[model samples]
Target: MRARLMIRYILGEMIPTFFMGVIVFILILLTFQALRLTDYILIHGVKVISVVEMMGFLSTSFLPILFPMSLLFAVVLTYGRLSADAEIVAFRSIGLGMPSIIAPALILSILIGILSLQTSFHIAPWGNRQFELLVTKLGSEKPATIVKEATFSEGFFDRVVYANKVNSKTGALEHVFVYDESTPDNPVTVIAREGRIIQEKTDLGNAASLRLSDGSIHRTSQGRHTKIDFSTYDVSLLDPAEQQFRSKTPPSLTIEELKARMKTKGLKKDERLSLEI
Candidate 1:
């Protein structure tokens, strides 16, 4: 009965401290992420609800690291307090051996280890993938967030865009200029009086549509010059970041996926190393 009571008492002390430590450590790790997410709201004009969802995904990613650190902190603090109060001495004096006193902490550590293993293998990877997908969706859905006014922006694939003024509320661009090198042999240049960004869902994925009014297309190829004037024109806007994100396997693949990838033939040294890591 005394042994059971001792075990229960030790657990009662450790469980609350463990949870508190997890909260404190997770907050510490998430501070920088929160600041970055704040930029998405303030600068990129992302919705608060989306930012909150991003934070939730990020918190799950932090759990694998935070769990072990928090467990260690809880153990050290709880035991240090008990030792300072001479509880350890009193327990030893009451015929409890060192192993008996340490058993409860050991059991708690094992439980935490099991939880941390599951988080590292499964939960964290899923969270990371979700975060990446969300960011990509945001970038594709709101192309204005990627393009800044009065600057040459090259984030769009195979194209450089410049806008003298951008209307945040309506996503309208004034005095828009685009240099398109999507065709290597013949390059095209477009200048427009007014333009707006539109998003469309296609079979492949979400695509950005840059609609221009009162624009002219200029092309030069094989020592020949061609110019065409138009009332309206549409240019496809593809962000390179989104393309790259789609092409590469996310760094946080589950352990099973990593193992399968490692078994593939003709793997590059760097890719194999990354998978192993």
Candidate 2:
């Protein structure tokens, strides 16, 4: 009965500390991402709700790393406190050995280890993939969200966008310039008096269209230059989300998928070693 009580007491002390440690570690980790998240909200014009959802998904990926560290912190701090308070001596006097005193912590560690394994192998990968998909969707659906006033923005695939003035509320641009290098053989420079970003849905997916009024397209090919003037022109942007989805990394793969990839023939030595690790 005393052993059971001691075990319960030790667990009671450790569990709360474990949660506190996890919270502290999470906050520390989030501090690193806070700047990037702020840019997502302020510069990329992402919704607050979407940012919160991103944080939730990111937290899941942090769990596997946080769990073991928190458990260890809890065990160390709880034992230190118990030792300082003479609880260890008292338990020893009652015929409890060192193993009995440490058994609760060991059992908790085992349970936490099981949970860590589940998160590391399954949950974290799913969370990482979801986070990546969300980012890609955001970039694809509204490429102009990344365009900043008085700065050259290269988030658009194979193009650089610049605007002297931008209307945040309506995404209207003044004195816009774009350099399109999607066709390496024929580079084009577009200068527009006024423009706005338009999101269009096609059979392919969401596409960004830059609607320019009173603009001229300067194209150069084989040392020849040509200028085309238009009252209104629409420039369609290529969505990179499909390409991003195709390049899945190891962290985004489950253990079974990783194993399968490792077995695939003709993998480079480094790639196979990475998967094995």
Show model 2 residue runs off by greater than 4 Å: 147-198, 202-205, 209-247, 273-277
> Cα deviation in Å at residue 53, candidate 1?
0.6
lDDT of 2: 0.87
Q: Against the hidden reference, what TM-scores do the models get?
A: 0.72, 0.71
Angstrom error of the Cα, residue 263, model 2: value is 1.7
Q: CA lDDT of 204 in candidate 2?
A: 64
Find the 10 residues in a row with the least total lDDT in model 1. 239-248
Which residue pairs clash in candidate 1? none
Error of 1 at 183 (Å): 17
Best candidate (score: TM-score): 1
Give one digit per residue, the lDDT tens place, for model 1 in 1-277: 6677778888899999999998998788789777788878888888999998898898899999998888888889989988999998998898888898898899999999999999998999988888877777777767777678899988454478899998766789999999987666799999999999987777667877789999899999999999999999988666443654554354578888888878889887877887777
lDDT of 2 by residue, 103-207 (tens): 999999999999999999999999998887777677766676777889998846557999999886677999999998766678899999999988767676776
Supply candidate 2's per-residue lDDT for 170. Answer: 79
**lDDT at 245 for candidate 2?**
52
Candidate 1, which segments miss by more than 4 Å at Cα? 148-198, 201-206, 209-248
